[model samples]
Target: MVKELDPSLNESEFLLEALRKGHRVDGRAVYDMRLIELTFGSDYGHVEIQLGRTRVAARVTAEVVRPRPDKPTEGMLLFNTEISPMASALFDAGSRSEEEVLISRIIEKAMRRSRAIDTEGLCIVAGEKVWSIRVDLHFMDHDGNLIDCACIAAITALLHFRRPDVTVVGEEVTIHPVDQRNPVPLSVHHIPICVTFGFYANGELMVVDPTYLEEQVQEGSMTITMNIHKEICTLSKAGGIPLEMDQVLRCSQVALVKVTDVTEQIQKALADDKVAR
Candidate 1:
């Protein structure tokens, strides 16, 4: 297993000192998030997200498949996350690391478990066939806060994706090509955005969108998933220093604000893409 080179003691101390003095090496305020940039591909359902130095690409694809017996009517939403070795020295090609696993799970919870997309709407035939919507997330760069970036990429791609039209007659399903029939958009119920907070100084100091060096120097972190409706989808704190109730609430408020901004950005980008095409 490859491991990241830990930051030196001096480097760590310098970052902490700067944070304590109310400054970040990247010049972002404690509560300020990094600028987010979205790039859409020529094909539908392909998107790339740039959050500062971090980069993630998401592609959405669908296929007709047998549905599960227990939930025959509901379509499947699957996520596959790959962290390239070129993204970081800590990652090995064609292998899943602990970090990659955690990121994938978090993304699953944020998007799939939250029911952001209308899975039941994907059913073409009850108990027999359903559209299996798969989201492939490729982590091209690992700066920090991969969970948030991956969620953004996946959700944006899903929103931009248009599946082929299908017709059924007497148990016979006919798939129409994009050229023959216009593709239809997915029935997305809501958008869930993830906002991560890195805690420092024993939880007294928290920063939004910590960079790679800040993540290394931080004591702990919490990830909050919320939608534009001000609904909390997930709150994840992994073995970090315990946070006070007020702190958790404060994080939720911040998450809501950030989620609103991101949702608008996604909508605007999609609108712009439609106009361009």
Candidate 2:
């Protein structure tokens, strides 16, 4: 079996000691996130998000297709993620990784399973045809805290996406081009954003967003997905040393604040784009 080599001993030691002393290499507070930059392409439903050094882009497309046997009345929403070497060296990075799987699951729970999109609205002919929405996610960069960044990109793109105008006449479907008719937006119930906290010093010291170096030395981490309503869509803490109850509760409260700030930022970005359009 091949094993990954450890980080440089001196660099690792420096970061760990700095964190223990409440210092970050970037000179930011423990809770201060790196600057967030969200940009939209000329095309609707395409969004690019840059969280510090990590960058992600999401593109959403729609098509008409037969509905499923069981959920015939509902439309389909598919998510595919690509993490190329351009993103990070840790991954192969074109293929999926355990990290990729974890990121995908959290996003699915927060955006899809939580019923964020009104699938019923996607039905054109109940049990016969429906709209199929596919979101293609690309990781342009991977500094750290990728799951949270990816989730933000996914939900934001969904909010910005619109399906074409369609009419059904006696089992005949007519689709109108964008120039012919304004597209209809998706039925997004809510925007669920994931907030990640990295624990250090035996889970005693916690940071709101950890970069790659912190990730290497941190003891464990937790990701909490929530919306502007303070509803927790999912709380994820994969295998690691157990955290104290106080840590969990404190992180939850902090996560809400982060969620509120991020949600507002996204709304502002979308509104700006709408005005520009």
What are the RMSD figures for all models against the true structure? 1.1, 1.9
- lDDT digits (tens) for residues 1-277 of candidate 2: 2333556889878887787788888887888788889999988899999999999999999999999999989999889888877787667834679988888888888888889999999999998889999988899998899988899899999999989999899989899998899999999998898999998777878898899888887889999888889788899999777898988889989999999899999999999999999
**True lDDT of residue 129, candidate 2:** 84
Off by over 4 Å in 2: 1-5
* Clash statistics: count for each candidate: 0, 0
Model 1 — which ten-residue stretch has the worst lDDT?
231-240
Residue-level error in angstroms, candidate 2, position 87: 1.1
lDDT of each: 0.92, 0.88
Top TM-score hit: 1
Total clashes in model 2, counting residue pairs 3 or more apart in sequence or in different chains: 0
TM-score to native of every candidate shown: 0.97, 0.95
Please provide, for model 1 over 1-277, each residue's C-alpha lDDT reduced to its tens digit, 9 standing for 90 to 100: 5678989999988888888988888888888889999999998999999999999999999999999999999999999999988889888888799989988888899888899999999999999999999999999998998889999999999999999999999899999999899999999999999999999999988899888988888999999999988888888888879899999999998888899999999999999999999
